[model samples]
Target: MGDLLTFKAGKVRYDETTKRATPLAGKGLVTVAHHEEDATFVSLVWERRGPGAVDSHDGSEETEREELLLFPGDAQWVHCKKCTTGRVFALKFKSSGDRLLFWLQEDNGQAEPGTLSAADNEISAVLNSLLNVLEENDGNDIVMEDKTGENTAALEDTLSTTNTGISIPILSITDALPISSFVAHIRSLPEQALKPYYDLMPETFEHTRENLIKVIQTPQFFSSVDTLSSVFRDSAGIGSLVASQLGYPYQGEGIEGFLNGARESGLRESENDRVAKDQEDVMEE
Candidate 1:
């Protein structure tokens, strides 16, 4: 485990029932919730020491000018509004660099000294929020991709194949059909398939297969689950990977959940092998 970074952000009051906090949010701040009850929170409050210009986020120059706020303070407690969870503590940093490197410990609730990893989520969320704030301040805006039409078309194709009176489920074919054959099957699919290839082109299979091979070739392929998890933790095109196999309509949350399951399975396998080896050694004695 690496060093766990800690920051102190004063005190906080969390309502066990309402699951929300006060003061901090009203002060032009945004809060992100963690799943664990005792998971530490991290925040990077910024204050500009000099002059800077806020511009339109549309990849253009010139808009507005203002001082930049960089750091806020230490860690503080916050809660989720949707659940009756316990109060969550947060750490604060001054610079974006510090916040990026600030790792948090994720508690599994029943275990002590919880899981520790570099605060990847905290950094991504905070930086994105800050950029959004700057964009708003400069009268710029966030861009949202509209793939609804494409997604719907893709979904229809998958359902037509799956919800049919077939001898086998479509998911079963996913394993038996070779990548080329599967793609060709979809391509020859009638309009009922609704152009599923557009959402994800047929060429995606080649790339995904190559990457999977890379993962298998890694020296730590049979190492700890943590090591293997790290390999696919931020998979280059994880969204595409899921959409290709799951038949379009891919969500990042879904991919992450699947990855977590795979990690747990790997860890259990490793432990079982270790125990078996120990028993074999004892028998030899």
Candidate 2:
């Protein structure tokens, strides 16, 4: 619904399919948002301040002189290339004119927008490269967990199992092994534990079972799982969680270290607790 990634960048263009690029006159606010109706559609919107414009995008803002460029998130490459003048991102696509380019920078409290420090700029460059890996993907990454489709097919296969087969498919949400056994198993499970979905159903089972199946069957679910895992794996502070789980020495030291740990873990009480509680009688109102 909102911007997934955004930055200020000037639009660049190629001349007659040549490598040489011509940077547009002015830079603008570039916003990246997902397609509202489709999970797979990622797109970009660039709004540059200029002469009067025809319309706006995604329902926000009625304004004059707004130059806008939109690119549907289908691109062959979204990599940053260093040029003699400065860094320009080459957002290559099968079609032309979708290259969303930007001048990467940090904004000082009083300085102009996009005036980032060198360190921040370096980090931004690295992140754009990472985005390239995620957004540049063209493969069909959605795959159902098991080799089965449709719950009915699974149940039928289970019911038709024969004596020639040593074992039934044991039909998981993902399997099938028997006619009588499967029926008995269904009767046995007032609530199936790990059959269709491997989640430990909550007290809200009636509310969530169908929702869970719908989520699992979604076309982008599998690929999204992989992409999110990769992002979290490389995210800062995740290492701290992994270290804590594995019983390693605390990565941080002293008061600063103790306070900066993963907040998701139960809060630790110590001599250096940031805010100590008082007796009920003396507590502040």
Candidate 3:
């Protein structure tokens, strides 16, 4: 136990039924003295300065009185469970921080209810300090008790999976095409690659091209392009539309000839070079 800590009480009252001291009327001083053996028992004393003299008498002539509001080992130290009709006295020492009922009575009849409270920050600090000392002397580690009553085993299972890195994997759009390969392909395309399409729809192509350039300059554009390319590759109707727009027959012998021409072009070598460069850059990174 440490030295007694005192605080100025802003209000004091008295519970008629419980017959316990309460703060009401005007402010007063409160002091708390700790018990050496019993951690729960504490002594509380209150001192109230009387009103100043109104006559020619000096204000210093007014008498101040001290009251032993609570004593060591008082029954008020233990909360009453059944009482419901008296002033409620409470003190919280844990993170719960809720007021714990310290005094109560079965009934108050017609007696007006009363309350006592000290709002000074120093008072709260002293209370907390007292709790800390008691916990230390009792050789107990203070822990935050879980009040939610959740399943502990389920929580532990979730935490275990997180710690072991066994969570589900997330796939992004770039998984469809390597970003580096997509960037290289765009860079290799001729500036007039869309000329045929533009010739077919001049105004529409102009707007589309402008929008495409803006989108391609952004860092995430490669991933979006990869997703769109995947969709086009998987859709036969889209491929036919592309062939027809480029002035090549969409099917039959013309399709075979167009395929043959594409294979014979030097595109394969350029693609291989791009792949190799992408791999080299990845390794350097």
Winner by lDDT: 2
Rate residue 125 of model 1 by lDDT.
Answer: 46
Residue-level lDDT tens digits of model 1 in 1-285:
221222212122222233322211111122333212123322233222234332222333221221112221322221211111212223322111111111122333433222222453354345444333221111011111111111111111111223366664222212233233333454464654434334342332233332332222222322333332443445666645755575534444333544444455557777999999999999999
Tell me the lDDT of model 3 at 197. Answer: 36
Per-residue lDDT of 277 in model 2 = 49
What is the TM-score (0 to 1) of candidate 3?
Answer: 0.21
The TM-score, computed over Cα atoms with residue i paired to residue i, of candidate 2 is 0.30
Give the lDDT of residue 84 in candidate 2.
22
Report how far off residue 129 is in candidate 3 (Å).
3.6
Q: Write the per-residue lDDT of candidate 3 for residues 114-175, one digit (tens) a residue.
A: 32223322344455454443211211111111211121111111101223766542233333
lDDT, residue 54, model 2: 24
- Those runs of model 2 whose alpha carbons end farther than 4 Å from true positions after fitting are 17-19, 50-80, 94-102, 105-285
State the weakest 10-residue window (summed lDDT) of model 3.
Answer: 151-160
Ranking by lDDT: 2, 3, 1
Query: Which candidate ranks first by TM-score, i.e. highest?
Result: 2
Give per-candidate clash totals: 22, 15, 6
Off by over 4 Å in 3: 1-3, 14-23, 34-41, 50-119, 131-285
**For model 2, where is the 10-residue window of minimal lDDT?**
149-158
